[model samples]
Target chain A: MSTASVPLPNWITYGLMPLLNLLVAFFISGLVVWWIGENPLEALRLLIEGSLGRGDAIGFTLFYTTSFIFTGLSVAVAFHAGLFNIGSEGQAYLGGLGAALVALALDQYVPWYVTMPFAVMGAALFGAGWALIPAWLQAKRGSHIVITTIMFNFIGAALMVYLLVNVLIVPGKMAPETRTFLPGGQLPKLDWLMAWFGLKLGPAPFNVSFLIALVMAFLVWVLIWRTKLGYEMRTLGISPSAAVYAGIPYARTVIIAMLISGGLAGMMALNPVMGASARLQVEFVGGAGFVGIAVSLMGRSHPLGIVLAALLFGILYQGGADLSFEMPNITREMIVVIQGLVILFAGALEYMFRPTMVHIYQRFKRA
Target chain B: MDFFDIVVSILGSTIRLSIPLLFTALAGLFTERAGVFDIGLEGKMLAAAFASACVAYLTGNAWLGLCGGIAVSIIFSLIHGFASITNRGNQIVSGVALNFVAAGLTVVLGQAWFGQGGRTPQVSGDGRFTPIILPFADAMREVPVIGPLYANVISGNNILTYLAFLAVPITWWVLFRTRFGLRLRAVGENPGAVDTAGISVTWLRYRAVIAAGFLCGFAGAYLSIAQSAAFIKDMSAGKGYIALAALIFAKWKPVPVMFACLLFGFLDAFANFMQGKAVPGIGEVPVQIFQALPYILTCILLAGFIGVARPPKAGGVAYTKER
Candidate 1:
């Protein structure tokens, strides 16, 4: 009667499960396309060509990838600490506000060089501050981080909406957004380098901001693998009691991990403000913080993995816009379907394979 | 309206609002009491709402729609249970994944079904549940205080509301009075000890989760077919999450959970009422204040010490029996 004696299907478990998940996602998306009376394969072809084929599309994909990189790192950091920080969206919003304020306040007084660092730091600090309340509750009071973080996301959104509507209203403007940044506070473009590298063949948003994201990704990789602090944080993630037994300060480590994650989420403002829009725009993060959960899961919580995942997501996002324009009936939100599917497959990978994958990996190491 | 009449009106809305949450929180209570973390309640409710709304729209049969909703919700619950219990995956991740899947797949299917991008057709009132007036309450309106409140708040609610309120007594009887309930509690609190004592831990947990699935389906039906006549994307809107918070804030007791749901329901109703009313100093109170009240209260309750509420020791751990 014991089902434990039954062997698992190797092909279905290890090889075919991921393909099946992708097939399911595509089939569901195809159904949406079919309802709109479009050939699914042709629609997918348009989607691919629109996302990665041309120069303008490539630039746009890179532009979107910048935000994903920061947010993916944010979620990955929290994941390593066994903390699901669903409030990253809220933290990013607060961070955008912080960056805007810093840009405005020091616009006339300081040069671009001084203001840029301070603006980024201000955003990170505000984001960390926003996340600290929920982290403290989880660490000190044993509250469920999932519910508290989600609640905080709503609170953050409300706070931002209230501010944009009332206190932070731009003079002589009716829109629920902040005013444009001063000239000196705006991030400078790498147009000179793009021209030098012959990248001026088409519309390009590639700038120094992308380089900063790459650097940050590398830095995160180093921090997670090469440092004692990273070791303790990862230890706490697996088992806080065991980490405490190993002489790590569980409370301090948890709070620090959450704070750093929020800081990275806040850093996502660099993309929309410093890179693309060059001003404080409303909804600049554009759900990337929430979407970062998918990226983190797909990336297996590694920095390099996240960067690749971000690139793939960026292509999908940029291409989705084109597909929507061409098809008119199918919207860009179909990309969300793909993202959700990726998260499901990655999260449930262990379930599909059971103990076989781990056993196989162990056997390979013995050689 | 007189002051008493205003209080009676507020109580009436509170009961209507609390009904869905009561079902969800009681559903959470069963799963958690049997050591299964029911974070997927939101996903279950959402999927059920979609199923019920779609079926009702197609067939114009409300009862069949309700059954379809429960069946679909039970299917999702089985998936969740299999992953978390049998495969020993992380319960939180599995729940979150379920939420994402429900949200994504519902929208995908909704667009396919209605061709209007993630919304079902407006359901006529005929396909929805109507309030059943209690007989002989026609003359109870004349009595002062408790009588007026009872007639106003308790007499005219939908059948689901009555059933939701009735679930508390049933849950208490099953948990404390019945042997099956005792076995469930034992499995949740200490699966190993229960296993040693010759009870099937898996069966008890499965029954508990199945019961939760049924209750949550009712909650979803109340949302789509009773409270509103149409289904919208992400209509659950974190209410299932708030129900989980209520379950924790009430310390997992069925009676306390009912009161907790009422407290949240009252806050939501009051918030809705306050949107247009211009307070003296506030000058048309900001909508954000009302929108954030329930979440703010949940955060405060969770962060502050309100009598130590401990989860079962084996709550999130999966049981694997040795052969």
Candidate 2:
């Protein structure tokens, strides 16, 4: 049976269905929390307070949101082109390397403004360049994008480890990290904005990258919804054969879509390297690339939805840390379990309750 | 050591390293052959590893641990079948979700039950699988090349290693020879044809998934109890993805799958060997290059440089009869 048997209103389809699914997920997560002998509601309360209660907490949450936004947008763009770009993690890793190279080479000589723009360009170019091989393989060589991207991620990680340990380490340092960037290369934090508003703000990594992420989200919306290239990409996603029949060059669109997708994923490096850490750290991308997949799925591939979803995950990350700290028994892994539950209900089992809901709606309409 | 001795040692290491890949790739073979693309092999293996370790540690019985692993893996496989088959959901999305769930649940439960770094207590003696020496191992040691080969490479492996190799031929027979195998293969190729011929597509697919679960369980058990003696967090470590790559490299055939696993295993062993040793012209090539070789090779192979590899006709598509 098809899911379109009983038509529902836009409000119920978009808003209610997701809400119901989320409630079920949270309920199951609550049972798991209780299984570990902790009060789920109390745990959730602590999570909210930890993530959004104070200025610093909010700052940290926003900082994480910045990373997710870029990666989520990357996945979304690729999705619109009928490509599953799971290599965002690898692309972001290479992007960090690119940003680091530029900052390291020029930080002592140039000012922050000059270094930042060049660093951004380097990251985008490198990230896009890394993604190009997989795209070309998919477009021309008949390789599956998913498998190639996944393999590329491992290769990228190994390459980074080699470079960090043997080539880029500081002269006498033991740590597998690059030399810290000079103050001139560092992006300015948003503490000044808080001060101007006469608000007391703790030192947080929230910086100019957050603003850039927002701007990029808007740009993505315009590009995807309004441009000729966007139309072709969406058409290609919907029906490749039809798009080919309509004179849309399939290979060119695939390459362009992946380039844009990779560029966005690469931009994620700016958050940790330039905005937060001020140095190239190993595994700096963490699991943000994978999280982007969930965010993109939850947001239904819309820019606004992605922004909101990213913020939600930011809360989960920041708040989950606090929850685990408070309830030592509820370890960090439990939080991951909860997040996995959310992904399960939100993605795989998305239409689980749809048929029942649709039947109920039809009956109500008849009455 | 001489070149012959080095080759023997590397070959031994290759067999040891490839056991897990062999099991997982064969598991993927069964599921994919039945038209369900499962990328969650890593997660299932992880969960099974944890479950087996926990049970073995508690009961001090390796056999019981193997049973526990298989049971847990089957439970997960059924959940996957329910989502993709009954609910008609996207198979990839379901597999991915289950993977995340498995990853999360295993660690969470491990911490709750064991309370020691999310690791189960180390099992010793009866709880762990020790190496078994073959009957002719001692006698064959004096036969020059054959003696060293049998003693070094063939003998002294855990029972599961032999089971993994044995699975290759058995899987080949079951997939190509048996009536169930014929129906399973037909379902993957065209479920509608099977349905028209009076076969139940859902039941056949579910059975295929259950069989996959059993193989994955054995792979996980081999990791925790047989190979490592403890369940380390994230112990699978992308071996499932590598196994998937091997499955693709083998083009879904059982005999080629074993060979592909051996190739990957050799690459891994070579990487470990080259870590501190010096090469003639290269003069101690970086270890990372060898470590990255399998993935890089898989990418090149997948790029159609070797040949085009085609999946099952109905793979990854949810089958629903038109009303």
Candidate 3:
């Protein structure tokens, strides 16, 4: 029977549905755990404890959360302008390069406080630069943004490989990575932030970038909801025909939204390169861009939702790492499985349970 | 190696590499022509590769492995169908989810089953698709021109490679000549029209996606059982996306799809052949250029810099009868 004709409550749409989807995703993930002869309930306990039990674990979890927040916001921004950007992985890669260039030039001379702002701009610009062509193609040429973005991801990888191998490598080093950034380039740890809880923050790389991520989230919220440009973007996203009729300037809105998206994705590099590695390396983005898509979908493309969703993934990643250590049979890739299930249940089959829920809700109301 | 031998080797490698692309691109052609966009071909092929390798190692039969691969791929296709068709969800998001699931699930299952660091044990004997020597290949090897072309390029390939080539003409016939073809194409362009005409849009799309799964399964089986000895982590690499790019490059037609795969396969072969080799004037070009060529060319084609590559009108949209 046809369903979903009636509007459900906002509480159901935003809150109950997401919670149900997450539970289903976790349930299936537990099945995978069971298939490998592990106790799913025990595994869940270990996951929660490993990610949140200690100060260092919490720091690590929040560190991962920071990157996811950037990426999730990236996807959310583009999504608002009716673009599905799958190239944030590549953009983040380029963003790392942008961040590295700044860190490299200034680390020997200036303090990180002096280098931070420029590095942020550098990362965002590089990421946006990588996205420019796909955005331009989608805006002006009517090319499918998805395909172009996907292709650009490969091209960006190739370019990065070429640069790292041929140009950026230190003259005497064997590795493709650049030399380590000095103290000026390095982000100070948030150990103090952790110590305030009277717990030692051991080796976690939680740093100032988390704060930046929050600021970006707030900015994204403002851009999507408050500004005139955001209004045009939302207008274009909801209906291109309607936007055109309303004179929303489709090309400008699309390009600007993508730039913001790409820039946010690019800023994800700050957490890893400047905060953790203190140097740029290959594969630093490491599927965080893809995780962003999941975060955005799960969060319903809202900034507040994205922050929470990113935190959820951060817990999974940090906890999954611990689970792998405890149960060798389950690898770190288990987190990826959980991530996919979340996307499947929350993003695609979001309404699969909606009809059933609506039916039950209506039945209860009738009673 | 002599020039002729080099040509034969490169040509042989091109065909070998292109088979997966050929199969996968043709698979995409069907689903996309029926108006479903899938970015999960890579994941499907990777999952199927792992499944095929796992089954071949256990059953000691490549055919059984092939069946296993196809079965798993079909299951994924059904999932995609359930999401996009029945649930009326975002096709790209659904595809993205499937890709991740396949990628993560395969490696996880592989590690759990084999305990070889996410790699299946190498399959040999009947578990592998050994090349069948075409008649008179040794005799023809000594002859010039057509002899080496036929003996080396055409012959000495596994059964799946030959099937990949044959699928091209069959795909053309099925896509353009049959009643199902016309209806499928119509649905991709205007599902509403097809629905109004009393044809089931969902059923037709599901069939198209299943056909896609069937072909992608062959592609994955070829990758593990025919092309390689065992499953490797991320072994499909970006071939699925390359095949998707090729599908767009071919503009979703069967014959053109074959050519696009061949072109990409040749680019790959040529890149590997040219690695560490210096040109007379330009010096040694980086191999990444060749690696990136297919994507660059596809991007150019996509931007209407070359001939415009138009997708089906109703592509990427979930069709609802009520709408």
Alpha-carbon local distance difference test for all models:
0.80, 0.88, 0.93
Candidate 3 Cα RMSD after full superposition onto the native fold (Å)? 1.0
- Tell me, per candidate, how large a share of the native contacts it keeps: 0.43, 0.56, 0.72
Q: What lDDT score is found at residue B224 in candidate 2?
A: 95
- What's the lDDT of the predicted structure labeled candidate 1? 0.80
Model 2: runs farther than 4 Å from truth? Answer: A1-3, A194-201
What is the per-residue lDDT of model 3 for residues A1-367, given as tens digits with 9 covering 90 to 100? 4666877889999999999999999999999999988899998999999999998999999999999999999999999988999989999999999999999999999999999999999999999998899999999999999998889889988988889888999888988888899999988888888888887779999999999999999999998999999999998889999999998888988899999889999999999999999988888899999999999999999999999999999999999999889888988888989999999999999999988998988898899
Task: For model 2 chain B, give the 10-residue run with minimal summed lDDT.
Answer: B88-97
In angstroms, the error of model 2 at A238 is: 1.4
Best model number under lDDT: 3
- Cα lDDT of model 2 by residue, A194-263, tens digit: 6776644587798888888999899999989999999999999999999999999999999999999998
lDDT ranking from best candidate downward:
3, 2, 1
Cand. 3 Cα-lDDT:
0.93
TM-score, cand. 2 vs. native = 0.97
Q: Evaluate model 3: give its TM-score.
A: 0.99
Q: Model 1 over residues B47-78: C-alpha lDDT tens digits?
A: 89998898888878777778878988888788
